[model samples]
Target chain A: MALAASGPSERGGGDNLLLATFLEKRENLVLFLAARLRSMATAEDLIQDLYLKVAAMEPGADVRAPAALLYRMAANLMVDHVRSAQRASRRDAQWRLETRVTLGSLDVVSEPAADDALVARQRVRLLAEAVAELPPQMGRAFRLHKLEGRSQAETAEAMGVSRKMIEQHISAAVRRLAERLRT
Target chain B: MTQDGLARAQAAAWVVRLGGDATGEDGVEFDAWLQAAPGNRAAYRRALVLWCEFDARAGDVLAELTAVGAQASARPPAARRSASRLVPPAGRRRSALRWLTPIGGFALAAGLALAVLPPTVLKPATSTTYATGRGQHQRVALGDGSVIDLDAETRLRVTIAGSERRVALAEGQAIFDVVHDARRPFLVQAGGRTVRDVGTQFDVRQRAGELTVTVARGRVEVGSDGSGQPVLLGPGQRLQVDRASVSQLSVVDPAETFSWRAGRLVYRAQPLADVVADLNRQFVEQTVIADPELGKLPITGVIVLDNPRAVMTRLSLMLPIKAVPSDRGLTLLRK
Candidate 1:
């Protein structure tokens, strides 16, 4: 089946206008779902599910605002299906994480190539070094919020700062990390 | 700003916006922003890649960060620069519980430790590394009277830091007869899982990618360093964990499992590949399965740690398999 077709010409825009808009914002939707679900892998699957639902849709009349309807369907799908999917995927992810041959102390006989693992380990080291190089406030906020997986409010409480300030620090830290590591 | 820089900045913004407790309206705006231009989407995708990569390797990064933070903390405050310095976060507030402590038993264990500590403080850190080459066996007696027997091709690092007696098993297997110290929790970290004991005799084997912990005497808790329910194993209980999942506990004769200490490799319905792997570590000549299907064949019974050729001959008699000498090692094939 044709999973996707480019947005129809302007004359036929209304037919799959919602799908077109959804496609444009597909990455954003995945990110949104990822935030809610705490897993990008699960978010990606849900997006595919959403795509199937949209693809199988029968041709309909002109829609006034497709974005609103698209999100409505997306939200409904998440409420109905994604919650259970999230739980199941979490258990699956746990098993996956358990089985992954990380660069831990164990000598995994069937692990990835040594060079590949060393490169990834080196990247991780670089990321840590970048985090260490961040401005003190940004570094502390990032260490508490991202690296330590603390809630913004909790991090704020720990650092004796407002949650808004923590958010700003995190945003700046993300920007800085992206700038530093993209190269 | 360069287009790349602008894209990265936009990507970073999206990450924060999407990652935060975003409402439906924020999602709509994000979608609109993504639709407005192809560059936005590409930029966000770039950021997402980094975001996801970091998420996948968060454990390694945090461990490295912690190590760095620990070192930085040891240095004088005036000597450190504020811009590049970072302290441990609040989430890991309880450093004493840094290693694995089984769920529900944390309180009980901590309470026990409180009552067990001596009036005198523990000594400074004394780190030791123990390793055994192929066909070699070594036994180590720690300062605390705990003895460890290292099997062939094993590498283990031991450190007595303050009240914690920690050992990191990098490869191979070891039988730890730990002297119980209520105050000093004996922890063995291997393959992202920790085996913690106050006093116990346990066999921990990290062969290939699988980690097997068999408790012989007393009780020991095995759990992932990541948040999960830690399992407590009693004597005669074995927990076998491959990289992917933890196998159900099998009632094993600790002696049979520990027979490797006496140079006898015992197997009970283990795959031929695993047996071959163990043999590869013990002998200089590697054993390779020519037919992939033959590797899955289950082989049972005891195989003495004799020379590779003799062992392969003995194996050939039991299974419909023959060994051919390859350029590098011995390859097993179906007869």
Candidate 2:
């Protein structure tokens, strides 16, 4: 199948076209990787890895089919990634176990300091109450955006409000709570 | 401390302590506020000391307050004194009550918090959804750049992450023109089995416990999530997986399965019942065959998506069937 290809001139043209096609389809390539990797960022990183592999391939290599070769390389990369992830997870688990003893001692010593903890509890409780007392809309916005860890833009979108409105609500909420808790 | 200095210090403390763990930006702001004035620095130091002191004893106080609050809320006004006995000393009782008042108010504050905070701060990392309303065909370009052409009244969830790309076909049919990425394997979960890609284009259709998968390019491994070697499908190969049995491999035009995405419906010697089922999803009025035997009749043709009435009229002319509008839907019967 490799020998059946036309002369050097035709193969060179095909290689150039294939390289362009690969570059043009980078987004599609990332999607393909993301679907398997389950993370878009990871997929993007893999695409870079794929590009480097493709770029390093020897020039004027007799290629029976370019698209098939591309797919073959991609398949091989996935197998290698899965093997490495398994090793990393195993190492992480071991590290967690090793550090547990040192961390445990710090926790034990901290437990005896009770008065400081009581005051902190009072402050948190006060803050929580102040938040709960806010108007329903303002309260929800604050909880989802502040406590729950959503972005201001995402919170606005979810609540069907503008980002500016979200910002205003948060500022007002903070001001009101600060005033109430001052006493 | 001067009143203004104390006020600024308190505000900074609230912003930090009540801000729910300090973020990087918060740290920067705190530093800036401290350096803003010498008095500000002194006030913050005092506030920080108070905050640290509070943190050390908060848990035990919170536990005690929780029990007292629950008791206070549960009992009648007459039973209130009984709950108060649970309170420790005079100072402890006053502090506990002070804590309870605010804690009770926190539930109200939670609602305010949602409105105030940024959505990204609370949103989960990712969520997947697949939806198709009546007579609607939708296409979704996933975050990964893969496009899913959903058949009418279909639903599916695409879950793409760094480690795996997965699509769960909850219902209906879809054509996937997958891009090959070797670092991540694309797998589609449909019906009772999963179809794992080998750099391929494919169509998976699931209806009433019957599932069919057709591959256009590369290879697909079709197997139940539980056991058995998956049936491998090369280009132009089709396989059916179901609870009762897996069908033998067959050569078929994979394009025919995907034609619906182009507003064309192609059927090869299919049962009238099956054709009606497909049409039902595409039209508002349901198509039904009154005669069971007539429903068993075979149908074949390419349906160009015109209006529902036009398509029904054309179907009636091509076959020995009539369309009757009923309360249930459009019924097909032997004419």
Candidate 3:
């Protein structure tokens, strides 16, 4: 009920939507890239890789949809980075054993910095408070879909409601959270 | 809605939709939306940051939240490893959240993000032991097309010969899809119980010396060593054997048991503590709930196995909870 005036508006027009879009959304994309990765360093590396790939593209090479293509390239780079990281981990495992990296223990994953973890801990409280303030149904919908990482369809099925309801609840929950969590 | 409000709403909707299996058009549309206005991207980034935070900390947030009017139950004994999870949660999904074990001290290094190593063995003809790391899953195809999907932190050995097919599931859980060869019986041994595949699809989960077998298709026979008490499980039938060697059979949807291999967790009105127990298995971080009452809250949905930290960030939003660093990965407290 609190989401009637919220959600995407049907509007699309020409506004120089190529490399310009990439520049405008670079910072936004950095947040996105960072979120998808386990560390800011990896995200930064991949974003740089993405820029190179874009710059290296041959000009006037049938670039049908530049903005869409840019985003897709970004996603592709992310996927590739993950695949390489996986391979490196396997190799690292073998390398650690060969070099006698440590004792009998074989824990390879990198640990998060204590300072970063502390900042995250504070942020979790702020976010959780905002979620607790939502309407009951809205809260549940957001929890199941957004927090639990369930699909909207899965959230609908779990709640015994329609997918549309889940979408509306999600939008409302996000709007409320953004408003409340703003510093 | 004001301009900012409208932008946040659209951004939120886009995040949800794009998070799911978005197509090429959605990307084009999203790009157009991004190019249309500058504020839209900032608003979207704000929403995205929160979304990312939740993905990272899913477990801790759940530990923090207290459901409205939920019973503020006392904490189960810390040493009672599986005792907390043994408490069957509310709803028709009685058999749901059968994590069965809530090991608070299930020691894992905190803050480390594990990358799931892909299943190494593609085709196995002889006896080979396949193992997965903590929070890792693998699907192995046998020399014969029979597939065995392994859950997180599992160890199993498989042997295939002309005479018979044998799988020794030493620990963890696996779903077996066997190709019917009447001459060679498919036998799986786990948690002191042997599950004989009478040409069926079934899942066997063994955690902390407790085992559960759920049959999805065809039939399976569960038996203890040297005992005539062989229990038969048909489609939708489940058999659970506890640490005390007590065996119980119940009706359950096999799909739920089969969900983990498919990269998602399916639960219906499962309690928060039990859900956290499941999360603990899939993550290196152990989420400890400060208030035991928070564990009573029911969670109904699927949880995509992203990293644990992001999930915790999101959990804080939906539940009355927050988290702090602890000896064990994270300690969750009420907001």
Top candidate on DockQ is: 1
lDDT rank, highest first?
A: 1, 3, 2
Residues B21-101 of candidate 1: C-alpha lDDT, one tens digit per residue: 555666667776776666877777666667666666654565556444433322223412343222323243223122111
Clashing pairs in 1: A98-B243, A99-B243, A99-B244, A109-B208
- Candidate 2 docks at the CAPRI level of incorrect
The sequence of per-residue lDDT tens digits that candidate 2 reaches over residues B1-335 is 67674655454443333233223233334434444565664444333333332233222223333333332322223322353322223343233233233322222212221111110111112556867766666555443334456777788877776667888998999877564556667899988789998766688998788889998667889988778888999988999766576576788755556556534466665777887888777766667779898876666555544345556666665567878888867777777
Candidate 1, residue B201: CA error in Å? 25
Judging by DockQ, tell me the better candidate of 1 and 2. Answer: 1
Docking class of 1: incorrect
| Candidate of highest lDDT | 1
TM-score of 3: 0.44
Please give the lDDT score at residue A37 for candidate 3: 57
Residue-wise C-alpha lDDT for candidate 3, range A36-104, written one tens digit per residue? 453456667877887777666554355445555666777777767666774343211111111112111
Interface DockQ per candidate: 0.15, 0.01, 0.10
- Flag the better candidate by lDDT, 1 or 3: 1
* Segments in model 1 whose C-alpha atoms lie over 4 Å from true places: A1-16, A23-28, A31-41, A75-82, A85-96, A100-110, B1-7, B36-38, B73-335
Model 2 TM-score (B-chain only):
0.61
